[model samples]
Target: MIDFLNSIDTQLFLFLNGLHNAFFDPIMYWLSDKWIWVPMYVFMAYLIVKHYKMKGILIILTVGVVIALCDQTASHLIKHAVMRLRPSHEPSLVGLIHLSKAGPGGMYGFVSSHAANAFGLATFLYFVLDGRLRILKYWLFIWAILVSYSRIYNGVHYPGDVIVAAIIGTLIGWGMSKLFLYIENRRLKNK
Candidate 1:
């Protein structure tokens, strides 16, 4: 069953990764790059400060911690333990996969740190600012999904890796957000 699933995974990966084109290649590569998203991060910081005001500092702090936790859990604990080779690095996929100048990333790719960090930030932001900004919440999730898909497009991660990482990241984000809110609320009442 596992082999069957893995075979299907590889096939799906081929289809998705195969859909690339010259014009979109650079876009996907840029989307997968962390440094390219600095403006977006700055915008998110602006929104946090604008919306939460005094609490924004604490929220931003928690967000950094949440992202760190997600990255560590996915990269160190999960990916290392699973030790799955990235499609670009797989021997069978040597010629079968398309790799960009961005490269295959780390040797293991079971759980994508990119996907985890994206989803963690999206989910955390959603929890903290959902009702406050109705439509933007949807956009946040869309951004997270795109970030996950970019990993597959980059050939550094399989779809399953992104999916599992998103799920794990969601849980981590939700838990951390809830804990922070709980503490914040308690502090407010005590004051």
Candidate 2:
């Protein structure tokens, strides 16, 4: 079953990586670049501050926790445990894979930190905002999807890697959001 799933993952990776073109190569590279999203990060900070005011600090802290958890889990724990080679680094996929200038990232690519972090933030915000700013919350998901897809497009991650990372991220996000809410409610009650 594992071999069968790996075969499908390879095929899917090839299909998605093959879709790259001159027009989208740079765009995908940009999307996959972590530093390129600083403006969006700043905007998120502004929104949290604007909406939650003093409590925005707490929200921001929770966001940090979510990202830290996602990054460590995806990059350190799972990747090391699985030790699966990225498509770019896979000998069988040497000629078949398409990589941006960024090249193959770290050796293992079982779960993508980029996808985890993006989806983690998106899921957390979606729940935190709840009914208040419906459009913004929905847009957060679109952003997460695009970021996750970009990992596959850039050839560093298989679709399965991104999918699993997204699931893990969503779960972590949900858990953190629940914890944040519980703490917030308790603080209010005490006040």
Candidate 3:
């Protein structure tokens, strides 16, 4: 079953990666670049601070924790355990991948850290902001999806890698959001 699924994952990765062109090459490369999202992160921080004022500091800290958890779990824990070579690094895929200038990335790529981090942030913001910023709930996921897809387009990860990372990230984000809400309710009740 695992092998079967891996075969499909490889096919899907090729299909998605093959769709790339000159115009989107740079765009997707930048999209996958961690440094490129600094302004977005800053804007998100601004929103959190604006909405919660001083209390937003705690929320921002929690957001940091979310990203940390997602990144570490995907990049270190799971990748080391699974030891799945990235499509770009796979010997069988030589001369077939469309890697960006970012190079092949680290050795293993079972779960994409980029996907995990992006989805973690997006899911957390969606739950926390919800009605506070209705549009955010929708657009944040779009941003996450675009970022996740860019990994495959850049040929560093398989679709399976991104998919599992998204699931891991979403669960982590949802769990953290609930924990935050519970703590908030407890604090409010004490006051």
The alpha-carbon RMSD values of the candidates against the true structure, listed in the order shown, are 1.1, 1.0, 0.9
Q: Rank the candidates by TM-score, best first.
A: 3, 2, 1
The Cα local distance difference test for each model comes to 0.88, 0.90, 0.91
Task: Report the lDDT tens digits of candidate 3 across residue range 26-104.
Answer: 9999989889889988987888899888778888999999999999999889999999999988999999999999899
- What TM-score does each of the candidates earn? 0.96, 0.97, 0.97
TM-score of 1: 0.96
For residue 143, give model 1's deviation from the true position in Å: 1.0
For model 3, the stretches where C-alpha displacement exceeds 4 angstroms are none
Where is model 1 poorest over a 10-residue stretch in terms of lDDT?
129-138
| Residue pairs with backbone overlap in model 1 | none
Q: In candidate 2, which residue ranges exceed 4 Å CA deviation?
A: none
Ranking by lDDT: 3, 2, 1
Query: Which residue window of length 10 is worst by lDDT in model 2?
Result: 128-137
Task: Give lDDT: candidate 3, residue 10.
Answer: 95
Candidate 1 displacement at residue 173 in angstroms: 0.6
Which 10-residue window in model 3 sums to the lowest lDDT? 128-137
Among these predictions, the greatest lDDT belongs to: 3
State residue 162's C-alpha deviation in candidate 3, in Å.
Answer: 0.2
